[model samples]
Target chain A: MRNQLRRPLATISVYGINLLHRQNPYVVAWWSAAFPGFGHYLLNQYIRATLLTIVEVIINYLTNINIAIVYSFCGEFDMAKSVVQPRWAIGYIIIYFFIIWDSYRSALVQNKLCHLAQLENERVAAVNLRPLEFQYIEPKKPWLAALYSFFFPGLGQLYNHQFALAFYAMMWWWIYLTLSRAHESVTLMMVGNFQESIAVLHPQWLLFMPSVVGGSTYYAYIMAREHNRLFRIEQRQFLAERYSHSEVRLFPR
Target chain B: MLVIGTFEHSLELEQALSLLEHDGIARKHILVILMDTDPKNPNQFLSKPTDLYPNAIEVGTAFATACAVIGTSVGFKLAWGPIFSGLSAAVGGFIVGFGLYLFVKKGIHKTRSKRLPEICVIVQCTEEQVELVTETLWKFGVLTVGRVKEPSLRA
Candidate 1:
């Protein structure tokens, strides 16, 4: 009986507008495995992702997992063993596995909901005008969205006009850039200060770059494609409503 | 006289619609029907999911990102360094993923091609205006067009 009350509207907010579309469950699971919170982010459960991400960063830092991975990779098994805090590591493991399972389960439920939403085929406002932000449905180039994220983590999100995510990603990218000393390392490498570049980098912070860059870029690319779909769906609705005139005669007068 | 044409859903088509309005066809005399794809053109997705599914680029981008993360993580052990290892993995991973996606798609579905005009516009007008209507549709690069005359009825 309450299924009628549960359908989320066009998913528009000052942050952005999104539609419930089907996402591959396995893909969502893989993203979560790559990074604890990314699967949730892809699911558009932003609040949970934000919280989980914050927890992952803090616990990972406390547990020294990144440094341990670096040490283990560098053949310093003893160093890796010595650095990790078992208590935090245990907790991190629990949370990590939970998110992966949670996301997969969520994806299944959401995928089913996606069919219902499609069946409903509710009308959406193409242009959403507000004083501080605006969102509109139009064709977006998926490659361009990927390219923007490649250049800078959050730019693709901005191009999709999903401002909340864009700003969130951009802010994190700058922090990663600053903390990793990535630019300084490149400058040094350009001049052949190889050891210095290694010395300047914080391995723990640098490690976050991979998942951050990957998750953001993938999300942006997918979102752009979705926006294009929304454009067609919207245009189709407009044409049908406006010009499929009821008065038109099937037989001549 | 009835004039009909098919078009892609694009801004140019919308412009053609407004121009038709300007050319004095009454709103009621025009009918728009969204067409299902011609069987010959099967890859283009509209109301239904197609072989490409949601996005064409997913195979390349998704795997690249996911694999790049693993490469970067494991790169700490490699002699060259994280940046080089990550880049190499992203490229290599994308190629492998793209190839696999294509292979699987090929294995599952018949070959596919580019777009076919998927919208149909039919206008009822006097014989004198048929030329004008056809010209407007043609100007928009309509994929196909046809004309028909309805028989007069006698009481």
Candidate 2:
């Protein structure tokens, strides 16, 4: 009688566990807010998210530069007149949709992950079973890894013995920041202030001026966002190290 | 030292204690481990495995509480010097603690514990006879058993 009763109870508990394991929408929401298509990437729909993020970023850059260029040439009042350009309004719409869609996609993915997690938990709980065992090589100290990254981005991953990823992150960011500083300096040397340049430069310089201002602004934004992401990576590393329960053990010779 | 219990908010050491009564776990048994004070555990509650662990409960609670307090105080505290200053301090403290917690939790809790395979067992049962093995190993209270699950994989 006891066994029979327990079996049904266990089944119900398993079901509940499955339900509880569903992915959370909060993560998607957070990611979308953090980076345009980050939520979609989180959901494993990588290609779409990447395309959307890239397109939206490009459009955003163009629009921002256009606004700045117009202001530089004609002042704030002329911003209204500049809207008639071929793709400006359309670009705005695309960027807006991308942001909204990314957020929505993130929510959907979280919900799915949650459900899958619950189902898995329920299946395991139903059986009087133990977790399977195997040898695990714990990563090196997580906090130190993170601290390394914090002081010098990507160094932590190297310390944790992930040399390839460390090298990539470091190389990419180094190139980016260096290039960005160089570009900014050149822009100042060549053009002075955007608004002032519009007043001073001859018609020959005018043609290139718009593209220059626009490119610099967009690149700056991208670099800043990337820097933020790297900083967070460090934070992540430290947390993993301090909180992880992995331990090193010695085997008999 | 074994640390136990966590506050719903990162209050001052004294304030956190005031919120909860002493339960079976003696006050001395539990330490209010501040992430700020301990540079080693900079992001104590934020990352993967630890974020999902049961031990992270207090850290989460503290962060949530801090967010609530700070968010609520945004508009009202702009009036006077003492009130504004006090609120500002509280907000600053909470933000720093909560940011560290969030960063740690998000980074660490990204993986699911069950999906990954990481366990080891070494039991010497060959020498024992069948009856002894069944009795000693299978018995409810015979051999000591332990489990280690990746907290990051948790829901």
Candidate 3:
């Protein structure tokens, strides 16, 4: 008697809540905005919603704090106020929009996924489905290429016999390193350590100057050498191992 | 749990169970292990649990096929750098392979809550849920439903 009455009451409560869920997406969205992922919890998607909330908050907090630190150091409060806070505030707003967009999209996706699962269950019950099947595919070797790229950006690509890619990567790597090195040298020269700048400034021995000539050359060479070593590994792998069909099947034969 | 060997078909599973049954192994003593199936051709199946159970196994041929096709397409597109394209293809292959496995596991866990096994069905639909499924089944009609988890493993 009492048990029967309790059962219907419990069911009614569940139905009432579910009805609320379907009726107002805005309520869910509002809760989510108020407290990261509250909407997801309401929708019964706890994990993804929680992760999104945590990541968004942490990223926002970190970015804001970093910007605040930069302003604090600038010392001029009025200048910092006009420049820093608004810039950071705009960034924060952008981040918030991104988070909102991602959350809304993910939530809708999860809802569809859940509905599909429910339908699948119903179908399984209604029809005779075949047992689950398993098809094997061999693993691909990326470490070779990754390592190759690491040594000599272009060399590894070249060793893989990817002449054009190797050339492009190498050219870009060279350009970046050269520009950075030149910039570093100029900054060092501007520091004006007197005797050190004088030693490098004389044209007669400019080739031997520590600041202008030898500076950044070693670093550039090191970067280039490192990229080369990486490519060597790819060369070795291509020669030594017989890549399985699935591994190279994505390419041609 | 006492994993009844990894077999490709339900009929094979039934056969293995029958062998144990004939050897005086009680029905309660057996656990039908659903090993991870191959990602490419999910129905083709494999016996290696370590390989199959990895978190990255995909369930269909579509993803891998797409990857291979894409690699070939990219290779043709960049005819100037066949070698570099090949390397890219290799990396892409690994990603697609690992991706399939993750996708399937995620799909399974996502859909698990809606399944009958996950419902925690009460034996009498009245008794509190016992820790084991057999106990609940016994309450319904299966008198000899055996314990198949931790205790069965010990035996």
Candidate 4:
């Protein structure tokens, strides 16, 4: 009876968001196929995703991949061949395919890990000694988290209560943006100053943007999903402790 | 000889290391690798434990010294006709030594990559002390234990 009295009646929403749903592995794979590190972002493997994205953009640019594709589409095969630096292009092919394969594999593995974690949470709840009082949290929406991260590199992590990671990410992102002059270049390009825009951009620093954006977006989504799962398990545990078996029936007679 | 053991938890690994220390194993002979299982635990994931290859620097220096000596001798012999053999020999020796140092460093890195794992303890000991070392590890409830072939202090 003391346990019942001690238990909090109200459910608290930790992040004040709704429950996160499971993501399809194929969908994640498709995202990665579209963009090299997108799948890793969806899987919440931030560092790997970031590194791969960085590699992808830099290699793609160095190999003149965009120009080659453009020339090929225009039926200028010779021009395409001329533009591509074979040395860098060969390395680009290896990394690009590897990223796609790795992201797909990681998605499958993370799905299994998520299932195992859920089971573990259930087991832990049964033996947990603490009273389920005062600290209730709600589920998070993955898409919203991703959207927040899209606006700012580390905002999603801040939402997830990961302060240090958010700080570092924000700091690095700001530095990259400043050093690359990416925004200014885009603005100039939009104003029909193509040569001036090209001159303003620093390829070395600009190359880092794709990876940072891909990593941030994906990380935000994954973290939100994980946070929601944890919230659900906690809520279940709290519910289990607060109500007795006799009081809460699955089906009424 | 080297004995390698894996442990599930850091506490158990620490206990095992302490037991090994109590048994008179030198601190330098023991190496531990702690793998992070929890993403929330930043301390575990972020900490880069010192590498096991303590002798890499010493080995690299030895190789560099040998190469430098050979280069100096060759340069002195080739420049016998009085053009400050000391300066040419010094430059040649430095270049050769630096190159050999880089090569040795690469080899050490390759060896480490091939042998090391995320969560294992490696201990270097004499052939006579292998049994005692394995026994101590077992007593502390190690997850697995085995003898590694050609276990050098350089690992």
Most TM-score-accurate candidate: 1
Return the interface RMSD of the candidates, in order shown, one decimal each.
4.2, 20.0, 27.9, 27.4
What C-alpha lDDT, on a 0 to 100 scale, does residue A36 get in candidate 4? 75
Error of 3 at B66 (Å): 44
Error of 4 at A245 (Å): 6.5
Stretches of model 4 off by over 4 angstroms after superposition? A1-22, A44-47, A50-54, A57-80, A116-144, A163-172, A186-215, A218-222, A245-253, B1-155
- Judged by DockQ, which candidate is best? 1
TM-score of each model, paired residue for residue: 0.86, 0.33, 0.20, 0.42
- Candidate 2 residue-wise lDDT, A81-172, digit = tens: 55435566576666665666656765565555544433332221212222542211122333354346534555654453334434644664
TM-score of chain B of 4: 0.44
Task: DockQ for candidate 4, please give it.
Answer: 0.01
Best by lDDT: 1
List residue ranges in candidate 2 displaced over 4 A.
Answer: A1-24, A65-86, A121-175, A182-253, B1-155
Give residue A130's lDDT in candidate 4 (0 to 100). 35
Q: What is the lDDT for B102 in model 4?
A: 57
What is the fnat of candidate 2? 0.00
**Model 1: CAPRI class:** acceptable
RMSD of each: 4.1, 19.2, 24.7, 24.4
The alpha-carbon lDDT assigned to residue A228 of candidate 2 equals 29
What C-alpha root-mean-square deviation, in Å, does candidate 4 show against the real structure?
24.4
Of the true contacts between chains A and B, what fraction does model 4 have? 0.00
